[model samples]
Target: MVRAAMESGELAQVAVDVTAEGTDKLFTYLVPRSLAGRLTPGQWVRVPFGGRRLVGLYVGPAERPPEGVALKEIAGLLPDIPPIPAPLVQLARWTADRYLSTFPAALRLLLPTEARRQEVRTLTITNYRLNVDDVEALVSELRRRAPRQAELLAYMARVGGEAERAQVLADLGESIAGPIRVALEKGWLTAGRVARRRDPFADEHVEPAPPPVLTPEQEQALASIRQELIAPPAFRQPVLVHGVTGSGKTELYLRAIALVREMGKNAICLVPEISLTPQMIQRFRARFGGDVAVLHSALSAGERFDEWQRIRRGEVSIVVGARSAVFAPFENVGLIIIDEEHEQSYKQEAPPPAYHAREVAAERARLEGALLVLGSATPALESFHLAQTGVYRLVSLGHRIDNRPLPPVTLVDMREELRAGNRSIFSRALVEALDQTLSAREQAILFLNRRGYNTFIMCRSCGGAIQCVHCAVALTYHLGDDHLACHYCGYTAPVPSVCPSCGSDKIRHLGAGTERVEQELQRLYPHVRVARMDVDTTRRKGAHAAILKRFADHEVDVLVGTQMITKGLDFPGVTLVGVVLADTSLNLPDFRAAERTFQLVTQVAGRAGRGDRPGRVIVQTYQPDHAALQAAAEHDYHRFFAEEIRFRQELDYPPFAHMIHLVISGEDEAAVAATAQNVHRVLAEGGFGGQILGPAPAPLAKLRGKYRYHLVLKGPDVRAMAAEVKACFAAARGKWRASRSVSLSVDVDPVSIL
Candidate 1:
């Protein structure tokens, strides 16, 4: 077939990995005889382009080359890495089209970071195995002549007749290298290279946990998911497991994965954050053991490559990881579960193809006929709306396991505390609760969504807040470093003795963060042990696990953290949870602020009373009677969603309309604004009938030294709007005068406008 095809002038359409605009489409290439029969769609290959070699993905055959253009032959297929599955190739195309991204960008998401760069390979080490039938006899015979060789053979035999070269050298010293070579030459031992996987969890020991008896609600949820797994419909409706916190949603995921394995298919479990991966991995490992593989951004490049290899080679039946794991290259996927399906971390914010893992997972499931389970205590309004509209099968786990009641919540009005002459950051109720909880020898969790020592430093004389040089946001004061830092751009500066605005020593640290809360707790309770978890403290690798371990071991009496500790954490020692300020997220400019506040408050509250003791939560907020805060205090998601959904419907927010956010940014504010206007005009004039809301400054007007202007296009069908936007941009690219100085980014179904 290869020779015949070569003679017949066969052509292959290759999507080169270059990111340039015009290179987004496939280029025709000649199929060399060397790769003719071996080539397949989705295989990564090297090809020549304009006197340079570039990596490209084979996108199947082309009937003919463009009329008069010359085609180049593929250099060779990428070695070691396995070809991407055909289903994934199709899924990538769909993602590219739906997300308004280039083909290469969407394709790149399916590959490991180092694998795409060809910078990593399977690590291998040499091993020596005893070739002699009787190792004891040989050792005794050589003991007199070659003592080192004899000792090496004896050691190898004791360790099951084989040992890695590195281990042997370390044990017997490098002096045994000559002996090992001599032994191999004399036919006394055999040496061969064995693949050594760089497992990220190699240092941790996970004990196998037996499956617990399922509650009736859990059983029903599992049955619904299992039914979909056993026999899926032509257009399968995803299973939405709307379980309250502590309702055993994870158990249902585990059982469904087990069922899929029994049916000879694989499973992918996605968590929202890397902080959650450790606990989720431990649980999955405890249930599935070595059959599980984890993939996430936190893993080293080598570990990621090895794990990808394991998944590609079909060595792992279950994959548990963060957002990108939705593209886990499992060929026959039977299930994909998005744990904490409402997390915004599941959405990619930068670079092109800003896809949400939930959307990608749903598409992948549809493509491969896999069952998608979206499990969340508070589902995203969009997902819950889909469930309500019959697009998804809703399974509810309304009660906690063992009939444990949801934690009782206390709403503390901070205004009353201020009126009562309290100047401290903590309210009287929270301070009292902490004292009682500490006296009772129980643990507590203080939840604050912010992470700095102070929210901002303001000059009392000028009433101006210190702001980031590159961004419009205020700079946070870090007490530990004695510096002011911009969380958005990571720019740091020394804390000035005098206010820059007024030239006066009247700078006041206003608003408390996690760091300040920790300090205040230590000052109030001198003997209390506290641990803080947030982006600041957990920036180093494995820091999250370390802080969590200390809290779990009861070495720390209280854990103070930002939103990182809000979900997927199961600490049984915690009997008290204090929401330092529930209004932090509630006051954000984003429309999802109310919903986010409800989720955060409810999730952090669920952390309490997970053990045998009844739990209590004290939420300190100025707006104690706010619907979101009240609903969260009562553990009533339905009430929050009911009111929130009405607001969304009235305002035409998500679940009622799909929005395409276009942000034009540059160093020159005028150019950016001009480009945004041009984009708006093009959309309005190019046959788009949707509402174009803005050519105004973005909520985050300036970030990382760039001025941003955005436009929001709202329509009923996203695909049609995306098509119109793409075509309009392509046609208007040359007409805009500021096109060269500014850049435009399109986000389909943006999680946050900021």
Candidate 2:
């Protein structure tokens, strides 16, 4: 059969890894006779394109070569790397079609950063093994003349007659290199190269943890999941586990994964943030030992490469990672669990194929006949709508594990505090609660979404704020560095003695941030141990783990951080949780501001009262009577969803209609605006049935030194809209040549327009 296939001159359809516009489709290439039997779909191979060698994915055999065109031969296959599974290749195609991205861009999502760049290889080290028959006699003869050599030989003998070169040196000292060379030369020991896997958890020790008894609610949720795993439906409906905080949702996931493994299949578990990986990995490793592999951005390139290799080789049965883990290379995936399904981080915003992991996981599960479980304390509105329509299996865990009472939330009206002459950043109630918690020696978490010392520096005389030259947003004041920095673009400038607009010494820092809160806490409580966790402080590797460890160890009396501390954190020592300003996210210009505000406040409030003692939350907000805040204070997700969904339906926002956000940006504002108008015209002329909302400046008008103008297209079907967009652009290319100065970006089902 192989000979016949080769004789038929089978042509390979390859998707070259170049991201140019016209190169989005597949190109035909001839398969060499030597690689005829080995070349398969989804295998990475080298091919000649435009007089240069480029890496491409072989996407199976083409029916025939392009008419009257000669094709290049498949240069070679990538060595040591496993071929991407056929299911993932198909998934990439579906993602490209659904998300309106290039085939090559979608394929890149299925590979590790270093591996796709071909910058990493299989790491190897030398191993020394004892080759002599009479090891005891040899040691005795050498002990008198060379004590170090004798010690090295004895140590190797003690360690199973073979040891790594580095381990041998570390065990016996660096002075034993000469002795090792002498032994090798005298035929007493043999050395050979062996593959070594770089382990990210080499320094940590995980003890096996036995399974705990599950609560009734957890048991029922697990049963529902297990039923689907055992006998999935023809068109399997994903299981949406809507459980409140501290309800043991994670435990249900663990039990379901165990069931999947029992049936000889693998699983993938995804977390929204990198900060959540360490704790999640610890729990998974404690239960599954070396069978759980981790993948995230915090790991070194070599570590990521090795972990990907391990997953590809099927050495691990479970994968715990960030959003990208959804595409874990398992031949038979039985289950995929998303921990925080509502998180905005699950949606990729940049580099084209802006896919939501939840959507991708659902597609992959359908392809592989796997069960998907989306567990979240506050599920996204779209997901809940599906559950309401009976398109998903809804399982709820309303109570805590031991029926611990939900933390009582107190909404402190900051406006009232100001009327009472309490002009401090913290309200009177929050200050009193912090003092009491400190006096009681209990830990607390101060949640502030902002990061710098002050949000912006403004001049009192001219009322003009210092802004970043690159972006339209104001520059934040960073006290640690004594400089003004742009959070959006990282542009830094020295503090000015006088206001630039009016030449008066009336510049003042305004708006409190995490740094200011930490400072105020220390000022109020002189000896308080306060640690801040935010983008500024947690930029280093292992910084998140370090701060979290200090808090968990009770060394930190107050933990001040941004949204990083909002979810996936369980610290029993934390009895008090305070939101410095609950109104921060509520005032955003986006449509999902209310939903985000509710999720943030609710998730953060859930962190308190998890220990033996009762927990209390103090939320400081100017909008005390806001419906979102009221619902969050009552711990009522249903109420918040009802109000928010009604608003969404009225405005034809996300859950009611799909949207495609098109942004045109350039250094030249006129060019960007002109391009935006042209795009709007093209779509309208192409016979689109949807409502086109804008050809106006985006909410963030300028970003990273570019003027941005956007248009929003809303309709019931996104795929049809995507098709129309492609056809319109293809038709308009010749008539109105798009300037090289302007660039356009398309985001299908965007999480946020800003």
**Model 2 stretches with alpha carbons more than 4 Å out:** 1-10, 68-70, 143-150, 274-277, 734-738
Q: CA RMSD for every model?
A: 1.9, 2.2
Looking at model 2, residue 513 earns an lDDT score of 94
Candidate 1 residues 266-302, lDDT tens each?
A: 9999987744647777889999999999888778999
Tens-digit lDDT track of model 2 for 600-672: 9999999998888889999999999999999999999999999999999999998999999999999999888
For each candidate in turn, the TM-score is: 0.97, 0.97
CA lDDT, every prediction? Answer: 0.89, 0.90
Q: For candidate 1, which ten residues in a row score worst on lDDT?
A: 1-10
TM-score of 1: 0.97
What is the total number of backbone clashes in candidate 1?
0
